[model samples]
Target chain A: MEEKPVRLDPWASAVKLEYDKLFRYFGIKPFQEVLPRVSQVFGDPLHLMRRGVIFGHRDYDKILEAYKSGERVALVTGFMPSGKFHFGHKMVADQIIYYQKLGFEIFIVIADAEAYAVRKLDRKKVIEIGLYEYVANLIALGLEKNKHTHIYFQTNYEKPYYRLIQMFSRKITMAEMEAIYGDLEPGKVVAALTQAADILHPQLEYFGGFKYVVVPVGADQDPHIRFTRDIADRFENELGLRRPASTYHRFQTGLDGNKMSSSRPDYTIFLSDPVDVAVRKLKRALTGGRATVEEQRRLGGVPENCTIYEFYVYHLLQDDRELARIYSECKEGRLLCGPDKQYAAELLAKFLEEHQRRLEKARDRVLDYVEPPEF
Target chain B: MEEKPVRLDPWASAVKLEYDKLFRYFGIKPFQEVLPRVSQVFGDPLHLMRRGVIFGHRDYDKILEAYKSGERVALVTGFMPSGKFHFGHKMVADQIIYYQKLGFEIFIVIADAEAYAVRKLDRKKVIEIGLYEYVANLIALGLEKNKHTHIYFQTNYEKPYYRLIQMFSRKITMAEMEAIYGDLEPGKVVAALTQAADILHPQLEYFGGFKYVVVPVGADQDPHIRFTRDIADRFENELGLRRPASTYHRFQTGLDGNKMSSSRPDYTIFLSDPVDVAVRKLKRALTGGRATVEEQRRLGGVPENCTIYEFYVYHLLQDDRELARIYSECKEGRLLCGPDKQYAAELLAKFLEEHQRRLEKARDRVLDYVEPPEF
Candidate 1:
């Protein structure tokens, strides 16, 4: 048998697949290989890394090695301010905050330029969302404001950062860019170069000298990671740039068992969603329950296919023993879907209620975190 | 007869054609239509405009009206720092200095980014040439340093200037870009957008509010002029931008009667060339004289097709009477190629000697005029 290559589109709204293909075809190492090392280097692994949510990596071991040697390391990531901040975004935020806690420098980009250019969103609306939604949520989720943490809007960054985009364009071809991002438009070309700058710029001397960089992204964003790595290689001699390490996490499944996205509001839960509205969406979520109560009790529930079980594993429940308890009960057919829905809804409602309070305060402090573009 | 559309490549060095076709095929109006108006609005016109060396225009009448009304108007132009400063670049500098004398704000861009990306020049070398060669020569040509005069490296400009590049890409398509530029690459796409930004950014609110802008370019660069005008139209509502007025000038003929370019050192003369070498090259220049002395005496020389006549008209003799005397003498076969070459060389040596003296003092003032990018 021959292995088939997989193509991933970072701009696509829905991306669902077996992630093992990333290892077999794309050379992404399984994150589990470094999970124990992460625990040894830092005090504890991020929940996402420990529980297999961060499923794969490319050179993440190098990031761990740099950290262990007491060398500087930075985590870089970006958010498109096209919609409300959802649970899928929180997965990325968790890794960022985790890295910051481990004393890694953090660089967060509000991708307002990408939203306006690629998504055709209004510039004012994009900036507004970038502030009130993305930056605010990150702050509420424990992204601290300190010298080690730097956040900026893409359109309002430093000159050298923009220079990287212009300089990187020299070595890469339109064909190579099209191979990673389908269909070439002027907007997509600029946006792709801008994204590469966003990832690799932390190492530039203008951005406080070179530091080992690691980006935490969803599996679909591996294409951008791959493209940026190539750019770093091309510029290594000219700019003293090195390829950044990256880890790919699985997407948070939607309520109906599809990909969770802010575009699909009915199936996605936002950090800002009202308590009752969120619970309503959660109660109706698809589960691993059989057609009937009797059938579920006889066949044993398939937690692997359950959205509610995924919520507990990915977000709601943090204690491994408790998550395991729920897993075995559901697997043995002792727990029913109705009670599981009610329980999961209670946990989600509690998290959102507390988060909304902090988000309200975070909204007032967005300017302290990042400066928006003047225009 | 139906007229055929003409396609132009700005990157191509050699551009030769009948100037009337520009009026017939493109919307560029004969500059002669605005010649008398230039004298009325800004006192005496530049020698280039007076002698029809600047032969075509788009919306130049609007620039005259703005100047007459005492409204803010600016002259924006750029130089690719891939080579030494030559007479072709000096022609552009004359227009910038001419506009500055009329109290028009000056915006000169050293296209270091374009040189590095499109021409693959070294970063340090590009910056060095941009500072010592481009900026120093402009200062020596009497470019004043004041609040109204702004010179910048394309890679080292402010945030909003770069923001315009990102925003302009949104409304343009690859096919539309390819129509203007022959084949598309990442470098070319980025360079095009950066060029558009360079032309239009003076009107942005971030750059001291809006001002009427005029760019003086060689005839081959009309493609960029047209593309920038289209961008200004698309961004009118969003960015409060208006189309810039522009003037088209004939390229200085090389010694061999081809396009004068720095790439052909034997034919093109650099401003920094030693007097002896410059004179030696000039002595070997092709002329429009008859094959034999008896034939030249009977049938007058073709002064219209002569490179030596072009030098007097473009640079050495600014007086209308002196230029007319040379033109008639050459046409009536009174001035032979040998003596004409000696006269032109003496004039060239004297000019280069005086210019190089000022150039030494101007080199020290380049840092005061523009800040070079730190790589």
Candidate 2:
């Protein structure tokens, strides 16, 4: 029998996330069965699903049904613009782009309010950084700027949004707030409600009320999804709100083979990182090789513990058969860490060049994608 | 030694308010010295100040200094539209009118946000009742609608106001929120911050930042005033905000002799109350009188405990000498309960008729007095 690792709070740094255990721990259903069916609906599942990054879900069957029926639905996700945009952020961007292509209404909330409240950034700076660092990167990653997509700052959507926050607040109590977000600072209280507002705003009457909604998030953000789902349930009878479905993706490993932390520049390959810098970072990244190249050839390697391998699985590789071959080669000592690192670096540099090109284009028409509260 | 009656939470029904004890209990400075001086500046002060209804203050000297120097200052107060407008509401209205005449810029917030958050009223209904029952009554009570006066709903002024609230929330913590409002429901948390925003809003750049400001509120609302003043102090270094000054009023006693409650309609003489209903309610009111008329002549009436006497002092009489005579007559047993009740009934009826006339006119052009947020 395999010994299971104890998963700590998902938000903590010690969380060496065992994604399979999280479904049972969080009382969420696994997404394994739904992926193939959803793939059939979308013709081909995105690389996130093909690579098994999206491992868990809650109420995702409703979303699958909406997709099958060609229902106008929404994909709601938010970003706190407090730090550099990295591969961890790219995971959400990729999912947003993939889902938008599938005709889902997209609401990308640049949580300027949350940035100001929880992260202590000024609203103007949050907006400026959000547009340049996060939103620009998102648009670069092919999040379409069209009528169906809305990217808004949390502070700008004040009128209908705050009133709607007030409405959601009626169901939530202080005890619940403390439970969801410990120690309940005033900013955290506002941020939590504002997030609930962000999730629910897409379903407001002006945006076409009462439709299936889904959020794509790393496992750390499940608490907010759970809180929002509870709020949606509270409004189900009155506002006809659907409890939001969520798909939880595995955390993208940092260049150091630890969880990506924005505070540690060496740990993240920021999207804005120069191609040379990214290549340098990847070259120095922790890998799964043994002490000597001869020993790695004899005893094989641990791709599971390799940040370079994770970069390939997460961002670089697209073909499932090719990824499988690389995994087997690492396990069997056919591949060396040196060449694997070099290959991943080249792939990253190429990806960054393309993204930077799109980012430049995204800068010009940024306003076309930005939206205010519909009400 | 004088026996002190236990006063319940002023927001609750069991409050048998011993108004004098409130100064020591709330740690507020007595307004006795300030009153006569303010009276000299504003010509006999308002009847509320003359009769000692305005008993305590925090930094009210700033207001007096503004008056003496002819400074363009602000008076900020808010009303919760939870019920019909009554004499308790009238106390704040009377002060707004008095200060407006003294050349202070007046900002009256119809707290539709607070009414929804704290009172659980629907926003639409709160707006409707706020206009018909509260704002209309304030206009009827001689609160002038001019370029210097701005009346607005808390919900309508969402943009700059919420950003300002975000600014205020940075200084206020969850512990302070619980201390001020107790139990810390999400609605109360937002409501508390909204009030801080309301007070600080008058000192914003658009309204002329940093001048003398005062809010006239019942003693129960002193917590919000205290909270806002602390927030104002926190911003004083950066924003040049003056710590808000406040004048606290004693609660208006109901016909049943407890503090007036919005839920206990029978205990209140609503400003919209019909003449016959007002007269009937007055007839059935509690009075500080002897059981028999002959015994009342020997003992005299306790004007201190008389609801009829309180009605006259708080709302009915404008002349200080006339009010003094009524107090003397009640103390001398010349003003018996039946006759005192009858006299108050006539005064209330006449006041209501004149108020109804103004309310009719205020109803027609109510929007002219209302303003959106400047920012």
Candidate 3:
């Protein structure tokens, strides 16, 4: 039987993503030149890279060349402070931390203005969430607090940044904007303009001008990346900016076997969830197990269809040998579904307990990473 | 013979403004309550008001009530800093100065962002023109150099001002923007957004919130006023801002009997022009005269159609008796067009010479009026 098609828009929760098909659809080159470079640059490929979760890129060679030339490259990945800060958001943070370890400058833009415009949230509430939830979680996730790491609120970085947004708005037409983001409202259009400004403003003359800047994003955010790259090209003569580079990563699947989303609390394991809440959520999660333990043992479980297996492969399992052992055991019927879920819940509980403790400390120092742009 | 219909839009330069029809078309009420109220408010009505040049208004009753109740009202009149600062711009400055004397707070916005976006001018060049030509000329025209008078560049005031602009963009739609400015490019849309921001930003909570604001504009700029008033109403529930009030003034007729514009250099005597240049320009101006001096003496010249006569009535002669005498002399064969042009040229030269001297002093003190907004 032919498989059903999956939807992949950014806002939907039920959209299933197929990485290889999406790479072809978006015209992104596969991340296949990873063998020698991964060893040379990272000593070993990161977990996300080794597992092919970050599957494609555009203009990434420019970033690699900048790194090889002993020149630093900047990384930008902004988040709208609208929904719950969840593990799905953590995927980008993970790559950002890896990039930070490789001596890349990191910029975290808390897109509070987008939240205000698109979500109709008040500025005060957006700012509160950006500080207490998103910034705190990002710091806990290993985003360094130094000159190389700059966090900023989109609405607050208005001086040169907003001026640049207005300038970029001139470079694009309403028809081009509609082509990229279909039938957008004025707020969404402004939000898209602001996002382009967020991506390219760091390359401005005062901010060291343009050499190479990389953005690590999920496949759904490719439109913003494409739009920014077009803007960078149009501004090539005037602003002297290089087209921005970006890597596309796969979306984290939800507990219900759909795409993870903050809008559905049951489907998302929020970064700030308490240990017991996370444990309860994992226990009730949907799995690709048989109806009976005896049948599960006989049939072996379909680990490829299991959210628990995905959590282990993507998040919790750091040891290659242990991950291989779990995979083989599930396929050979040596491991049962109940025990596997229990093990996953315990691992998540331990992680959440430690993360919550670190988040408290991170909250106190989050503001240190927020750099207000000079006038 | 039937008269030709007038064309009036913000971008055109050949519009013949029929004030009564325009007031009715733009939904502005005629200024018919000009009895004792004018003398009571302004001591004696300014020449623009006395001559019916300040002809119509919207929500102007709110401004009058605010003034009567001893509440301070604000006046905002922003100009795009793209062209020569001419006498056409001076009409708005003259009104601002009049309001300044009546204890009204004045805000003059140098719309440099709009110039950069719509005219594609560089930021540095726009800023230079804004300060040296526009702001200095306004100061020379009697805009006060006090705390009550604030002048700002739209791009430079990006922090709180741009945030307010993003907020307003959410309140409006592409359809609405198209309705106001038909089929605008993204640049012009942004310029329109920036203009609305310039109009409403002074009422932000940090800038003393909203009570009443009055914009002095020509008949053509009624679109911006109308658009901003709609935004003010849309944001009423959330921001509690009062609708902005506006008064419409007639456009100054060019020397060639067209609408005055800086793009046509021969038609405009720039504020920065030398006294000799102003005199030369007036000598070559269009006038309502017959084929010969004898025929003009017999038919009597039409002072109403003479640009030199308008220069005296609007800019040069402040004495009512002298202005009336000049008007009748040109109409009743007592004065010829050549001598009238020479007298008007001399009057303009003397005024411009003194104005240039004051402008030099104003240049050193322009920063006093440039208040960077605090969010």
Candidate 4:
């Protein structure tokens, strides 16, 4: 008899399933209580009904409170052109489009320098190739060419832009650099200074006055923002520029029951994946239940721990009631992995069709955002 | 006996006088050595024979060797605006004009920042007041407006101008900064860096290449340019700027045997001094001779070491042969200090006639140079 792939730890998968939920997994209190406050401030800007991808936040509640008191806040995000875009990044765009629709002015920095430095590219070709891929993909998503959204490269500007980056860095302590960057090599230390400079750049200058800046990133970058907050007041004084409210949002995983990454092609469906390819990847994706269909029907499956259900939670279903129904049905054996995968694939494929069509028409529209403000 | 005046030490005065003779009093080397070297690579851009108030040089021989071999070189100098013109400064204009006549692309920086930093002025009022004084003084001194003479403020500009100071600083050990700046305070490191940056600022960025630069400065700055040369190679490397030849000219002193400064109204004969005021100041000026008139006549005044004769050589008198005659006659007691003073005053008054007239008419021209370059 052929031995089945043994069901490894489901708790490990539960940890993975905890996308926006990871902040709760990690015990940060601010992220937990922020949604109601966010809703109070902007009245569900995206009409999100319930939070979808945002798992964690830091000081988000304070920002929301400030906003409800009629304070202005801006949002910040970043993209490093390391490789092709996939569904994981599409979710990032979806969240951005949502928040942006709610009225947050956004700063999206394309990390060409950091990307090139880390990836070890041929220096001569760095900007041309990488920037093209980034610009195209960003437009492919639902990002609008709005006045409030600034999409810029890290090094392509002068004046109020990187000028604050320089002045802010002048006040940063070396001890602080160590905390944000870890035990950095000399090159990494320089990179850390640049990174620290980046966090301060947009808020301190782009809008003249500081506003709330929300960073949508994973757990890896929390250390950087934490260090930024510690030094923000001092850097503001030294730079003679305004500071901003800021927060972060972490996301969860996809089909292959691991971190949502394209390293394993079957792990993520590309935003441009063919309808059939999308369907097959989702259909074959792992499930958390007994092997034989008869036995599975009798013994309830673990809905909270299933990767297939994670796709539905992160992507397909937004309604909390619908999600609860799906969750209960799966646990009761009324639903199965095959149907869940098919539903997610259909939603994602439909989303991709509109996205690909929008990508063609929005090329010039996205390029228009690159124009600098007169002042 | 009547209360004796509280007399200062003769030895202290003598020591100061001794040091100032070859160094301070005659800070710039004789133009004989300076101009031809400048003319070498510059290939005599200015048609006239190189000579004037902008006299004296250091390492001009090496510069000539390079210049004659068709290597380009640069020139550096400045004007300080002290409200009115002086014969003392008219000579500086003459010197700068002579160098420009010899094909040197001169960097005439108005010492506005130094004046503000040292003098402590209101920022809003300073630059305007300075440029008015500088432009009038320079044009009066007959600075050729175009054809390679680009005058700028010390406050504005980027080029090989200030960056070389930092670039070359790595080559300079702490021993150097301490020696020159004298236990530089922590807060003043930026000032020292500015000093270093200044040495190479003219060569910085995409500034057209220069092979040499000569600074026409007061003797006090010898320590700076000497340090500049010591680190020239390394400064070139760090800055990504070319290394240019440099010379430091010692500005001559006052008729009253003291350094020429704006505050010591009597010490420096203003170019705007009614000729009689200049003559009167020259009459009361200190002499490097015995107290008795007979003794001074017998010994001949110490012309080489005397501040009065130093001015004649550096300012009023241009012909080397005539200068040699005055020096020999004065030291031999053949020419009296009283008559020597009168001769210098008369000669300077005649030379400054047109410059004073120009200053009277050209104060408004200075403002034009204050705007941004059309890059």
Candidate 5:
């Protein structure tokens, strides 16, 4: 069933609303270009290339160098955890898995504190359900705990991050906020201020001080990425902290002609979806080609605007030349949207099945990595 | 040299300046009655009373109750290692000793961070001088390191006090400051709020919560005390933390009739002062009666205005009856200001003598009590 646009928090600062500005700032054509570079930087040792799917990145090469230098770069991601996980959850989980093979750390924050502060969660339940949801997914992702990733909530009060917050509060002048938020209304300024604190919090103490941290987020969360990086730059000098260069990756879209969101079940094909259910979902996938074969032959298709291609750009196939071949053939009416949809559906099902097997085997091994870090 | 009366900060609230209004709001009397009650409240338990002499308190009696409850309440007091010891310095040290006997945990924050924040403090000299000033005095005051007090600075970021600051900031409303301190000029509002965070930061954690705390301080510091108590009151219902109290005392003035400040050498007699030197200083102390004994016999002296009685009142003397007897004798000119001064001077010498010996013996003992509290 279709519904109206979600009521976005006016203070939440939408990522999609600032897309053009961000693209111009980063010198990227669009988010699609950033996805392909993930494979190159991650080092295609397994070579998941079927077609050119992923696109562009910022400082992807720098993070790649860390791997070459034997310094591990962590793939840091987070969940708001206000609700249950769905298809988009599995998509990000799969993305984390790809990086784990490349020997990167996976740092996942449940963001329970953020969720509680923002959405007004009952403090007691904030961690309970979310921690379970998170650990289960990480287990399903086949993440080996201490080695591959750490899934932690941000409610740790005794951490040195609290000290960093104290110090951070001293450095930023009211003049800065007056210029930016314009006399931040007291209604919830601390929460807004804490958003900056969250990204920089991990850098202050013994979390291998300021190494390459990549935030893998959906395109909608780009505002947080941009805001956090700005805070990191200012805080780095203010704190005299050893700050490593950071980058943000934006995932493309869903099966429908819109952004992928957990709340929108129809647009997403979850990793756990049965093969028949996946096929039916893909049949409804939005395509860029002209309606009929007669009209499609005369007019080239708009693959760039197609949501299916966007998903591939963020996830599935990786070979650039193969993607180019498919696009060109479709434009020339050599390959139709229906057949392409079936290929994507089958490809996704096979990947999911293989992932499920890996997840089942790696579940117990993940617990050790989740423990507190020693100094 | 005497400096000009310090000008109040323009951003400070009118209500904040009207310390009497604060007294009324807190259901406490004006500072006049409050100052004298310092030692009287905790009579006999402490070897020497340093109530009005010590003068300022954060939560003086709540801490006493906490101490009496057989709760671990270390007396926490301190000074920034600014310069050599003075009489005003001894006032605080004496108060710390009183609380130490009452079985409260004592923490002496050298205010090193405060020194750095307010003025330049040489890092190399800070810890050294702060230690010499506090550790020795604390020992002389009968502070057993294992039993009495622990002295530290604005410690590493690991301090729980920083966590308390964070919690305090979230609860206090900016409107409360506008009400308490009044209108602030542009951009100064946020920094105006940091004082509440600084003064209220005491590290005490309880069973999934926190403990009661107190600060004994002079009336002049009521601004900080009010700010901190406001923060505590603000968060009392929200965070489930105990509301800390402030014990306000009227400070002892210099022999020259000004605030008994360490900044002036003569204003305070150092606990480290030699017995003969202390007696000589007392001989020169300001007197408020007739010049000659016979001339003063017809005219009653201002015993209420006398600093000698203030000392006896502050440092626990034989009794209040002794103070009343001395007051009657001085007012009727029977007890000349000279003899009265002589008596107090001798009392102080003996007091410091015993305290110095105890301090030397208790040096290593204080170190053990200062260990990080177990949660």
Candidate 6:
């Protein structure tokens, strides 16, 4: 059978995907191949890496090599400040905090410009969300405020960084941009070039000199990664820019088994969601259970397609042995949906209660971390 | 006979025109209508305005009203540093100095980014030309170093200026941009928005406060002026931007009677050109002398078509009485091309010698005026 072609769009709210196609068609190597080296180089890999949540990569091997050699490496990522910060965003924050602990310099861009232009969000509202929601949540999640950790609103950045966007425009053609992004508009063109600058500015001499850069993004953002890599190659000799390494994580599935997004608030859980509210949502999530108890006992359960199990694997259960025991119990039909949901709810409630307390304090510290843009 | 359609292209190097189409089709009012008012409002008018060289305007009456009412007013213009600063650029420098002397705030943009991205000039060379040629010529032409006079390289501007470009993109569509500028590319899109920002940024609260703005440009730049006016209207409530008033001048005719440009070295005189070399080029200029001298005296020469007469009107002589004498003498065929060329060369040589002396000191003072981008 002939396979359908895949096209990734960074701007899409919910992207349906066959993740394996990323490895086969887009030259993204299976990230599992480098899992062992990650443990050896960084001394116990991130939970996402170990559990295979970060399922694919472009040049993560180079990132590992740079880490092992004690070379300067930086992690770059961005959040579109169009909505509330949710668990899907936390998944990225986890990767960023993990890299920061491993001594990678962090550059976080709050994409207020993209949110206002492409997403048509209110400018003042976008800036408010970027600060109180995104930056505050990252701080609550233990994003350190060191000299190496730099967070900036896209509109309020340094001159050299904006210069990169202007220089990159000369090398790429419109047809090439249209291929990755379906249609063109002035906003999208500027946003795309701005994104390239976000990913590659660490290598410019004006931005601290050269460093190996890696971007941790969702699978749907590969188009931006591919476009940025092409730009890096074209400017290799002139700007001394190298292709940025990237690892693509699978989307955090919503309670309804769709992609988790702030736009779908009913199924998604915000980090600041009240304890009872978050727990109630989790209790109603679809799980891996059969219709009849007799049938469930006879044919076990399918944890592979379960949203409840995904939450435990991605966030709640970090111990390998405990997570494995739960997996086996579900597979053997020993743990029913009702009892398993109750346990997941308790853990989720505890996590939200503690996070909210820290988030309250974090809100007051956002200005100390990054200055918001003045309208 | 039917009139041909007119399309103004800001990117094209040479544009042919029948000037009346701008007034009839594009709604550009004749500057002559406001000439007496300029003399009444700001004192003796500029030579260019008096001689009808600055032939058209859009909302210039508003600018005069703002100035007369003791409201803040600013003059904005740009120089694309693709090559040397020729007499064509000095014309703009003259207007800038004229406004500065009138106590109007001045904002001069060194379009280094546009030169690199649109003209495909070397980045380093563009910066060099912007400093040594463009900025130096403005300084030599007596652009005062006052608080009101601000100069900047496009790539190295402030955060709010770049922010305006980002926000402006939201309201404009690709189809709209392509309508004004045919066949779009990434660089041109950014350049167009950047130009709008250049003209309108003086009114932004972050730049200073709201001020009445006027741009002096050649006829080919009408597209940018029109585009910026539309942007100003769209952002009127949000950004508090008023549409900038503008006056359009006829392009300086080259010695060969084409558009005078830095790209056409033999026909265009650079402010930095050695006295002898500039005079040699001027001596070989095309003229309006009749085919036979006997016929020239009977049917007077057409001063309207003579390049030598243009030099006398545009530069060389600022006195209206002396310029009118030369025009009538040439029209009566009493002055042949040979003697006229010698007189114009002497004037050209004298201007270049004195200007080059000031230019030597001006080049050393460029850093005080504006900062260039570090690549």
Q: Pick the candidate with the highest DockQ.
A: 1
Provide the lowest-lDDT 10-residue window in model 1 chain B. Answer: B6-15
TM-score of chain A of 4: 0.82
TM-score of chain A of each: 0.95, 0.92, 0.91, 0.82, 0.72, 0.95
Residue A208 Cα positional deviation in candidate 1, in Å, after optimal superposition? 1.3
The runs of at least 3 residues in candidate 3 whose Cα sits more than 4 Å from the true structure, single-residue gaps closed, are A1-17, A21-26, A208-211, A290-299, A364-375, B1-17, B32-35, B360-375
Preferred candidate (TM-score higher): 1 or 3: 1
TM-score, one value per model = 0.95, 0.89, 0.90, 0.61, 0.70, 0.95
**Deviating ranges (above 4 Å) for candidate 4:** A1-29, A45-73, A81-92, A111-124, A162-240, A251-354, A360-367, A371-375, B1-322, B329-367, B372-375
Instruction: List residue ranges in candidate 1 displaced over 4 A.
Output: A1-17, B1-17
Give interface RMSD for all predictions: 0.5, 1.6, 1.7, 8.6, 5.1, 0.6
Q: What lDDT score goes with residue A57 in model 2?
A: 87
Q: Between the candidate structures 2 and 5, which one is better when assessed by TM-score?
A: 2
Per-residue CA lDDT of candidate 3, range A242-287, in tens?
7889887777889998878878899789988888888888888888
lDDT of 5 at A224: 51
Of candidates 4 and 1, the better by DockQ: 1
Candidate 1 residues B1-375, lDDT tens each?
A: 132221211111222356767878889998878999998998999998887888889999999999999899999999999899999889999999999999999999999999999999999999999999999999988888989999999999999999989998899999999999889999999999999999999998888889999999888899999999999999999989999999999889899999889899999888999999999988888888999988886676766677887788789888888777776676667888889889999999999999999999999999999988888
Steric overlap count per candidate: 0, 0, 0, 46, 53, 0
Worst 10 residues of 6 chain A by lDDT: A6-15
Q: For residues A171-204, could you state the per-residue lDDT of candidate 4 as single tens digits?
A: 4554666665654332343344445555666555
True contacts kept of 6: 0.81
- Model 5 lDDT per residue over B321-371, tens place: 666677667666677776678788778888878866775565545445343
Model 6: how far residue A93 lies from native, Å: 0.7
Cα lDDT of model 1 by residue, A239-343, tens digit: 999999999888899999988999899999999998998999998899989998998888778777889988987899888778878877787789899998899
Candidate 2 local lDDT, B1-375, one digit each (tens): 142332211122222245556666766777776977886777777877766678778878878877788876888988888888888888888888888887889988888777776777766677887778887888778877788898887767646677676666667788887887777788888878888888888776756555678888877777788788788788787566777888887888888987787889999988888888888988899988988999888767777777887787788888767777877676677889888888888888898888888888887767667743211
User: Once model 5 is optimally superposed onto the true structure by TM-score, how far is the C-alpha of residue B47 displaced, in angstroms?
Assistant: 9.8
Error of 5 at A110 (Å): 4.2
